[model samples]
Target: MNPHTISDDKIQAAVALLQAGETVAFPTETVYGLGADASNPLAVQKIFEIKGRPIYHPLIVHIAAASQLSVWAQSIPDDAWRLAAAFWPGPLTLILQRSSQVPNEVTGGQDTVGLRVPDHPVATSLLRAFGGGIAAPSANRFGQVSPTTAQHVHDKLGVMVGMILDGGPCHIGVESTIVSLVHGDAVLLRPGRLSVEAIEDTLNKKILLTQPISTKVRASGMLNSHYAPATPIEIQPADELWIRAHQLANLGYKVAVLNLSDHKKCASSAAITRFQMPLQADDYGRELYASLHRIDHANFDRILAEALPATPEWVAINDRVRRAAQGTTNETRILVRTENR
Candidate 1:
């Protein structure tokens, strides 16, 4: 299919396909989603098949409004309602006990499901017209760079997809912050644009924070190697990264450098591609994924990113960078040179 801008006709067509138990790619503020009728087992199955995503891991259901939450989950906690009011139509997902009406296929046979009302107008329109929750994960093959634009979806899943809603570039450029309330305690399963402090402020109580378990995972994109690029990624201290980058370059490795700022000096012989993120935390968070998307496309032998300050505001971005550097070998420690420090 030709890549075109999103239009009312395209939205209508995509909605129709979803109603017929087929999958379509649509945009949200965070990332493009491969959407299917959450209530339709066959349609949900198609999503897992297309993305090669395992069924044991659940998918997040996108809704048009907070009013639609009860239709998908068994009960909404008071905190969940408060969060919806504060962050709905934004990038926050709530995981709650599923109602019997929610198919096992959508929730990976679990008793809970993740639901969110996206801030994007096109996604909201599609959800409202379809009259049911839509199960949508990022519109990319499983364990690949997520699509932030309509073209990214087309480039990855075109022809394999029934339709693509060209909603332009995603603004948030990351997945939603997933909060699981299924176990009677508010636990943050994944962090996105919504910081833990923001969620705590709305709930009026401290929230439990937990990292994704590598074994027996129940949610999507929880794996360590997820959102990885074809090239290797290394995470190290700011000062010493350039010397290692130069060493890799001398060894015939093409490298890209992502650091906090461009103030650092490196050897002249280094064949390094450098990108400087904003010094401010929120600005850096918003631009994080787009930068990775660009670096992933560059023909680099590896991506070496400098570690950010260990502070509360940088938590979410740190989680993503750490996960991006995770490899099959389960190695998190890259070489750290004392001189660079």
Candidate 2:
């Protein structure tokens, strides 16, 4: 089966499963989403049980088109419409006040709901056939690396999903940019495949970089530790990555390096492994999760990554990487440096 093509029968099968209140994992431009009927509280609860996701963290409701927006969300702001018109059918998610039609299960008991029209043939086909909202998050266990391919979904979710729609590898390979319009201002709740500049360009106004404290809304991917791999991860400066990786390897610990520099410059040693990363931000985003998924299963003692630049273009990548590396400490670095001295 082609990654870009999904048979109508397959799509209809997924739609049927969703309509029956069974979870269906389908491809989106960003990542595969574990989808459930948004109107069914019991069905939505399955998503939480399947992913082990906390009930407090809301799921983004995937719709077939922008016209269905009012069906799930109310008090739709003008900026939400503008952003939807500009970035919908793509990787931008708009957060708006929940409509009475929306169940609290989908919104995590919050008054606001996050919604997006994903730009993938399989996802769009299933949504159109179902003709309703499907609340979905990354089709992986909570706090783990998100799945980017059907195989990743199957491996991570396995028999838990009623069906898997193999649309191919995710094109964008990251979550959508979540912008909250519930607060009357375009607040960026999460950085994702879509850039902040693009949203501002469409709205012709600067979006708030940080969500205000008083009006804070709980949205997906807002946690400090998320998208993490099982192996502990540490990030080091490009200037120091080699040294630190070498130190850990010399310390008799197996280490893997997510080298962001030129591959040839970072030589792998007997105890050290290196995976070269893409230089451009877009390419990097597409490979980040898949690479982490690969690295996570390779049985390394620790994963060390070269730090990315803190530029506007790399904001989304940095955000994901930083969150993924949360709870990682510098104890290894300290041990290595102290031993070398």
Candidate 3:
């Protein structure tokens, strides 16, 4: 079946489904979200069941606007307001103290809740119509490639979801930058399109970044090996990436290259596929998920991604790359061996 387009009627139908304690997939600036009513325990349970996500990993609550933040959070810190003013309706998620009104299932039995006001029109409209926060995560199976388009959701959930609100491709293809505010200070839990420097500038206070490895994490996508494709992925320097790609190709393994530059490189074997990401940081972040989604389905034996720049600007993108390539059990090690010519 063709993917359904976004319309008021479709939005109303999705809202009705949520109100009736059902699951739906809706578009957001970051990616499509598999959402359920945050206040309803049963509806929230469906989200976890559908994605096969662990109940220990909490979900983010999407609201219509900043005005609704207090409805879900017990107390909104001053920094949260500043961050919301600077990044809300965009791709930043603020984790705050959860109010009693919020269901435990939505917060994964934690005292804190992650909240965001998506920039996508369809998401805002649906949230407004529902008149409450909606718990949503990337519309894909747990630990799999995230959905950047309506077809991605349909391909994953099929008719299991009551509705799909298509809003074209996502503007920011990766998940939001999640900041936990439970400690009265803004802590950067996850990085995304918004950089750490950007968040610091808004709050005029130094932000503490969580280590890559954390044992006390409460949200999904925080683990080392997540958002991975079926094929194993390896990261290497640009100078060595092509040689490694060709080496893997010659080894009788289907290999694909994800380049972060404009110019395309020559491949010795036709079996090696090359894909270039946008030269700009923002565009690259927006296309990261879609690119991975494609490579995951290309029947490649493994994916060899070129290491991105170590500059501060590329921090978020690199974080996602490392996580995506890391898989569920392996580290994203940099291969430094020379090609045997």
What lDDT would candidate 1 get against the real structure?
0.80
Question: Candidate 3 clashing pairs?
Answer: none
| Model 1 segments more than 4 A misplaced | 1-5, 211-217, 267-270, 328-341
TM-score of 3: 0.92
Q: List the candidate 3 regions with Cα displacement exceeding 4 Å.
A: 1-5, 211-217, 262-265, 328-341
TM-score of candidate 1 on Cα atoms, chains taken together: 0.90
Clashes by residue pair, model 1: 89-119
TM-score computed on alpha carbons, candidate 2:
0.95
Tens digits of per-residue lDDT, candidate 2, 89-200, equal 9999889999998888888889999999999988888998999999999999998888999999998889999998888889888888999998888999899978899999
The deviation in Å at residue 200 for candidate 1 is 0.9
lDDT against the true structure, each candidate: 0.80, 0.87, 0.82
Q: How many clashes (backbone N, Cα, C below 3 Å) per candidate? A: 1, 0, 0
After superposing candidate 2, which stretches have Cα over 4 Å from the reference?
1-4, 263-265, 327-341
TM-score ranking from best candidate downward = 2, 3, 1
**Prediction RMSDs, each to the true structure:** 3.7, 3.6, 3.8
- Residue 329's lDDT within candidate 3 is 36
